[model samples]
Target: MKSIDVLLAVLANGWVVSAVLWKDSISRNTTDILRKRYRDEKTQKFSTVFNSRKPSLTSNPASKPFYITLPLDHFTTSNTDTFQSRYYVQDSYYQPGGPVIFHDIGESSIERYAPGLVDEEEFTVSMAKRFNGLLILFEHRFYGESAPLTEVSRALGDASKEGLTAFFKYLTIEQALEDVVVFANNFTYDFQSYPSQKLTPEYTPWVYVGVSYSGARGAWLAKRNPGLFKATLASSAPVELKVDFWEYFVAIEANLAASGNTNCSADLAAAAAWLSQAWETQNETLVDKLIDTVYQADWENYISQFRNQDDPRIWDTRRDYMQDAAWTAFADFQYYGVQGGTLGKFCDIMETAYSDNAPAEGLFATESLDRAVAGYTKAVAAINPYSYSRSARNKAKLKQKRQSSKLDSSLDDYAWLWQVCSEFGAFQVANTSRPQNMLPSFINVAAQIDQCIGTFGESDQVSLAGPNVSPINQKYLGWNIELSNTLWTNGEFDPWRALSIDSTTEDAPTNDTSTTEIPQCGTTFPRGTQLRYVIVDGYHGSEFSEDVVENADDIGLNPTNTIGGISASRRVTLTSTGTGTPVADARNAQSLWFNAMSTWLPCGTQVFTFTSPQPSSSTPFKTRSSYSTDGPSTDGSTTEGLTTDGSTTSNPSRQSSSPSENKTQSAASLVLPPLMNLFMLSLFAFLTGVGFIL
Candidate 1:
């Protein structure tokens, strides 16, 4: 009865039962599971759009580039109130690959990247090729093609009855970041939807790299959207979260000392003293001459008067040297050397008062000496407001006026003296001013100087303005803190707006251990988060040495490929490893040091090192690394194998047969015994089934 019922059910539902049973068997099959897993693995391997494409080289690639323009603080109702932002992209060379994009972050001044200065297009191309990605360059919100929105709004009376005050408050750093993100999203989507030349199939990962001011923006974007950018590189950045004027003044002072200007220091002091005294005497003619001198002093004359004072023949030598184009070039090179960070020897040459080996040239020529005296006299006279006051001649009134004028003059002299000292590096500027003032000034000046010097010369300068300019601290408070953090926290080589003061006392600890102690008055110390500091003994922005560049290659970075390679003579190292043979088994440690040094060694002579457990008789291995050339010492080794080469040390306990032995065994196992047995079993089962069927 049961067999008859089963047969009837199978005959009626054969197709349905077969379909359901087959589907269930397929779902449970190992082959099917393996196939699904393989597909998932493939997808994961190509997850990043950037890695999806194949490498190719083409002189004239057939692809049209797409561009996006963003408006920051654009006023809808007024033409004057609009600011511009721009970004560019190109499709990937590989099909179904991600697109590449580049962004150019603008610096602070309106005159930045002008016709005579650094070529923007060249810079863009170099950076694009260096990163092996698409490029995007945009003017800052208030500069260049971008409009000064606040100024424009005020001019157009965009604000309500609240007047210009309300309209003037339109620009801020956060708004700048928002503008960048918006432009990026819109541009990336547009490229993905309708590529310029159909080279790239979809949007790809983005990378942002910036120098000086724009470095601040790149850092801001990276920190704000870590997931967005695969990586970010910022150079010569000043990333102080808060503004402090005194901090900047302090930096200037430090720069002055760094300049290696011996005569300038003493001269500046004397000039200040002279002005203060003259102000008390109400000297008018001297004040006017001093102002005129500031405008007329050429680079050579200035250097001679300040740094090369002891050399009686220095001015003549410079004049003679400048007569020949080759000599002029040599002088320019020397000047750049001083500016770059080669101040020790340069200062020695100029230190006539301290050294017996003085050059024949006097610090200043006769004409220059005359000019300086006149300028000093003029500056002194200008301090006296009463010098211009001819009507009040009463004895008592005259005395009171003279005293007041003297005090004002003295203050002005002090200010100018501090500026000169900071400019030439007589003392650390941070030690001269209060931190509140120091911070903002440091941020503004440091940012400006780095941008200008990095691209142009100290001779070329630019101006910045806004209603919020004064009390710079208040104005900078509006800047994005994220940008600040990104700038300061990344590399010690990079400078931020934070005030950095030198220790006044020799006994003062190097580390910032006094967490709760507020810096003293007139000290330009940084507050808030303590910065990780590394002092490199070389010129600012000097190229790293070839050896350092070679070392960098070990760490997977080629600084030469990125920045025109370093000069062969420059010595740059990450550690304090002096030139010598190892005292013990330091070979591996040295190799590790070489790898670690490459990561952050700027284009110059550099050495790097790491700290590890010293080798002992019991351990017999000193697992450490260290190196140094022309810069500060660094640590780049870890306990878990060497992080430099992306490899781990083998465990001492684990032992395995060599590849040859394993291969011999694997080859022998490729015999027919297992196959023969399986075949015989299958054949017997098949015969038994046949017999049953018969």
Candidate 2:
């Protein structure tokens, strides 16, 4: 495979953009972007299953897939044209009038992983079980089995001028958001050929939750359509659309230097400086020890073919860049952490090698130099364990290309690369002026722009310019997102945190300066909808992980507080600094989020009030068991004499025999039209009335 292909494969395999730069060094625990399969503790693989919604009478029911038909173009004259998009549902814990949690699938394949979101020990599942709610996962358009085009050949076969343009015309972030709104509305009330869900008296409440890129979508979706989506839990979401995102590397280096080893960081920095000097001096022996000269020669030869082409995608450089490997190592350490299988051991080797050599007169003695070289080799091996295997694969692919005369293509890579080029240009480049800069100076924004253009093989067709990202920033308000009823939670160690809405920064103001207070480490702003931020001491997707409550010996902070873990890391809480609200405890985010959901959509309370009289044939519906005159009571129970308007009322003249029978009568009392379907039909009708129909 070409170097570009390898980079794109890494992008497709995970949601984090850094994954493309440091593939084998990082784990797949971040976001489920381009992953093929995931394995649990038992080694049980969760792979994608490609089956239609309906199986014939002889086929198994478990293999069935669900689909939603959406318009080809929702905003234009061709909006009447539609395509079937796939989705998955897990309703085992679904209650008739409980809350609904929708997990947004990012820019990758969504299959059996859909069910696992609610079936496993994830927080979504726990929330579902807590509220007896329904869970649904929808596939993004052009990803997984939800292809807009019928044939793979038509979608990704041709990369030539016209072919690339035609392939990505309809695949925009706006269209995907529209698709989500359509899915959310439709899934709440009806499913074709399955039991139709009743949305009556107490309409089920909906909550949107997502991590990483999807996390950004979740916040925006709720912000865009507030009434439809009641609340949002956008974990580790990057709200800003950046161009030269050098701050990302700044955060990465900070995290690495703080990785429990001060000496290791110093040695790594020294080594990077040394490599740069060697590259400039053209020290053959030193350069060969650092980078493979043969590989560099091959790269130069391959890249030279397209240099003179007037295409912006083709790079013009001929120099062999060093320290990219070191940058990758530092990135892996910051992203995955030492516990998540990163380069701590390799850093140890480096530290040992550095101490033994000591760099006398800016050069090492023969024995110590060999030891340091050996250490460097071990470290590179850890970073790119499959280096040999990858070379073999590339050679085989080249031979196959020579015979068949075709390049290996992937629509997944193309799709994501387009998004990066068009919207979030968060290209991680080195900020060399900073004191702690470790990445090589050549790995800058210009290089990333070239890569973006090169990957798509388009100059004018794709924008490496500013026009594409400006409108989005203007529309969404960038990091100063003014959406209410939205929550932003991020892990302290997540490098993407630099680009997100961090309350502590001068860039992300709370608008109320006196009230805006940044917490030390494990604290959150008082729980209100006025754009609050919480920074937890965890890795990516930490807020969404299940919190395990376990007894522990007090480590001197709070003896009775006990301890909890979100996977390997300990869970911490955010203190409530605002007046009248007490400090939160026990899985701070989970507790705060759970309380917010209950406040947003309480079970024992009626959200909507009705004035029309019930039909004569309608049975007496049972009232909720508990109610609070002031609001939600401390105890999770219902009271008698509760009315729709949240006021106390006398008992009904007639009452059902039991709660179960009353529930049945309540479900039967009033009829509800499928609002989502009706809305879609009305949309078409309005378009026809306006003479915009095809």
Candidate 3:
């Protein structure tokens, strides 16, 4: 995807100005964007990547898919049936008994990681090949092609709330983790060799790496199944769970202010305040007008085209339309960071609303608050507003999209929301107690309750309880979390940091300056000195996309690719001190991980390439590419033996085939998957040309 920074100035009197040379990447971006689905297709085409015991590959092995039968219900036999979970293996680098590096792809398609398998620049591939490690992309159940239950889970025309009930029952944190454990127990990889290596963690050193929801899964799975994985690197994992997470907007507001654009945030607050005032008063005409202005002149018809049916909520959208409108610009910032175009573009629109006449004073100054409302509207018009909802229409669209086959979606909404509704109560609410809330005050626990009832058949009451998020915490000690040989990481600007070990920590985090404090991998017993990292000026999924361009001017490039290439080439700047920048820390984290992996397992170079690789400047990609018709199956074979039982096995001694002297290697390297319905509008962004999709 092509990207060029534009800096055109806008004057008052409601007019326009000239700008920079524009390059049309939308066609190319769309082409590149659409091609991403090939990863899944290619993955399924070559069902088994492992050809033979003596097979050899001079070049890096392309990632290929394998399916293993996992119990649909790990907890009980009520649904004793089984479903196939997909995993991709890139084992060309795997030497005899070398460590296994598992990059968890939770709530994402296998296609999203197609590059990580072969691209040496990616830490997953580079480090794995260096250490002669077997790199495996482990797909979490119910996401991407790993989705189970053809008829009701997601894209088989039966994804209604009633239809998805059975499927949702199988999509649980424990069940997903158990899938990993069972895979481990049954792992029969002839890892780059003859006899079945039975590459169980007992026989090999397995490293767990994941970001966002996968990050949380990595942490929780590590805890549940100890021996399955030796070292864990959970980036942007939200360990804490809660309802009414008003603090989410706190990060956005702080980030906007920190970016030296206090007025942008102020304007945002003003817009929210304006809309909230109208919403509170129930001014139908103004509300409708405000929404129409934000959407389009033909907003009603525009919305109706893609709608599943004649949704009653279109005009009187349930779950606080005002709140949804205010959050439209910001729904993705948490996932893509401050640089995600929508949020920044929204701010720009808000600023230019009256900036020409009265530099900083306009909206909220006038009697009507027209400028504030207009700014909000124009911003959404310029940039796609994240108006994803679990309303019946979206459900019908997902259920029936198979008819057109334009796109097939993972039941991300249903699966993730199930966890949130049942146990993980992380409702994105507003902190209304504050004098000026960046997010509209319309969002609160009650609003979330309406959402829960509206989506699932649950009428969970509004409880402004402690971000106690205790249900999962009680099962696993929330921030009071600890694991053996684990590396915990979070992005500084990641909104989910509020729930990760980064924000809710029982122990002080690992100081960046004092990384050496992390003990040598094997010396410590039951557990090692765990490492906690905070990516300076980083956002969700920072580690996964470390290749993004970084410099004195650009500290971060909000990648839309990770979330499906929708956000666009929004950029952020920070004074870079060669030592602690986003890219720098990302690499540093990788360095630390490599060192720890070496200490824990037998591998090629005791150290690895610290030489910097060329950075990638692709447009922001937000989620996975489109899914193929072939998702995780109820009938499939398993070479990976992918499971997460975590049960211990007799230790098998392993030796590094290409062992080398321990040398010091230089450091390098979701964010959590946001629990928002915002991702649902990615298609809208792609087709509308309002925002860059790829």
Candidate 4:
């Protein structure tokens, strides 16, 4: 019995020891797997991770990719002897092992608070996916999270009035460019602390992308740091240094006209004309009614179309309108038939128009409208060249025609009555006889009203009026010359900026007579600048359709095959054949573009190509071809083609002596599987371990 008991105890002890050893082994193995996936280093410190220098180019492939966001110190100068600036850092993210990095800047504060609008975050994600690169989003100083510490400086004394403007003047393009460089340099090193991977700065190239205001910044950055960034994708950016308020007004008018509201346009124009005549005659009662009618009608017919009051679009439009109006009104209120107490009365009317139906009949009823008006007025007054009265007079003459006619009599008369009451109370304070003090404000307001009415008051009018004076021409000059050397982008449809319409030709416009040109792949501009233009089917930056959004991975990973379509092999075959003539070649310029871009961009080689017959041309010219990386190509094609007839040739065959030999050595000819394999391995491991966990 004693011997048997001993044997049982020995077996139990051995099992216990084995279990303890097995648990420890499993724990270590799990930790090892995680470590391999993350590339984590147990001993690395946080500070060392954050501020590490860029990795050397030849790091191991198994290393985990680094990712980070940090602040960068940027500087800007002031007009005064004092150097006033702030420390602003761009928010950046770096994907491990990806060849490209992206940088984005935020919009102005006015753009952000506007009510019915979509933010840029969704768009940014979409673009990041499309480009398959790291994204860096930067905040403009004096806006959003980047407000300057000098707010107190503005609050000290009367200088506060000009403080914000002065501060903004210091936040110039040059300083913004410096911030981009610093961010790029730091992005390489910040990834060092990750346990599973190694990131060396030398392995990845950077691509800068911007939208709206940031688009301009992206373009300028690309120009400034050609070595740092491989390419730039700028969307809806307005980079012109000088902008006219009239352009915005005109855009609104054109938009209204395009909506096919003939009756509304006519009525609005008539009402404006009546007001102008009334102001000239000093018909205070008539003028007051006219002003009220104008506000209500404009809001109902035009402004309401922007968005619901709660909508971001509505908020943005209202904010813009108020800002523009206040600047124009305060600069010269009399131009809008406002004087003396009229300014205060106008504020009251504006408040009522914007406010909800409430018990106390709130003064400036709409808090949003009131705040917008006040803020805009303050901003405009600070920057305005002329004083109030002077601006008003200039506005009255220009807008007289538009203010005269009333649209809906009931709404017009009701608004007119309200205006009369306000004016009656305000007219008592009118010191119209004392023109000197009031004239400046009046003139400024008038100039703004004139701007709204599609007329230029004396102070607001340009002395030299011609093609040179046109806003489009002016913007082009600034973009092509002063702002060109910097990385920047201008939009084709943006009211404040203009892109070249002459994209078909290579020659940049010399004078007013020259046509503006679009940029394409293989299209080189003077001074080694390359231009690329993308034409989307819908409104600018339209989201992908539901089908596309749902099937992105399938489309990206395994595209469907079509027998008659252009494929990788077919494209190669076309290049190999070398049968098309120069004109036939000129017509196939788009195909050549696909071929060229495939050579230049690492991402481009992965894109699938489809060729459709050109609709505008006969025989061989009749076929139009289009290429897309995202999915199957849309069937129809537009008339845009690559041309050699201009300053440059579109046909690679004509441009190069030995086309067949060149095609063989072209970047497109290289096998894509090796790079794709690396991408897949990294992607699979990343998706499995990271939150994707698929």
Whose TM-score is greatest here? Answer: 3
Q: Rank the candidates by lDDT, best first.
A: 3, 2, 4, 1
Candidate 3 lDDT at 111 equals 53
Compared with the true structure, what per-residue lDDT tens digits does model 4 show for residues 624-677? 111111221111121222221222211100000000011110112222111112
| Per-residue C-alpha lDDT of model 3 across residues 26-131, encoded as one tens digit per residue | 1001111111111122321101011112223444333345667777676554545776676777877777767778877676456545544656556577667667
Cα lDDT of all candidates, in order?
Answer: 0.27, 0.46, 0.49, 0.27
User: How many clashes show up per model?
Assistant: 84, 8, 41, 97
| RMSD of model 1 against the true structure | 35.4
Query: Which residue pairs in model 2 clash with each other?
Result: 1-394, 12-34, 53-65, 523-574, 625-638, 626-638, 626-639, 627-639
Worst 10 residues of 2 by lDDT: 652-661
Q: 1 or 3: which has the higher lDDT?
A: 3
lDDT tens readout by residue for model 1, 283-379 = 4355434433322233233333344344433322222111111111111111122232222222333334333653233233212544545533332
CA deviation > 4 Å runs, candidate 1: 1-83, 87-103, 108-127, 148-168, 188-203, 241-243, 249-260, 272-282, 292-694
Q: State in Å the error of residue 35, model 1.
A: 58
Could you tell me the lDDT of residue 414 within candidate 3?
Answer: 48
TM-score of each: 0.39, 0.63, 0.67, 0.39
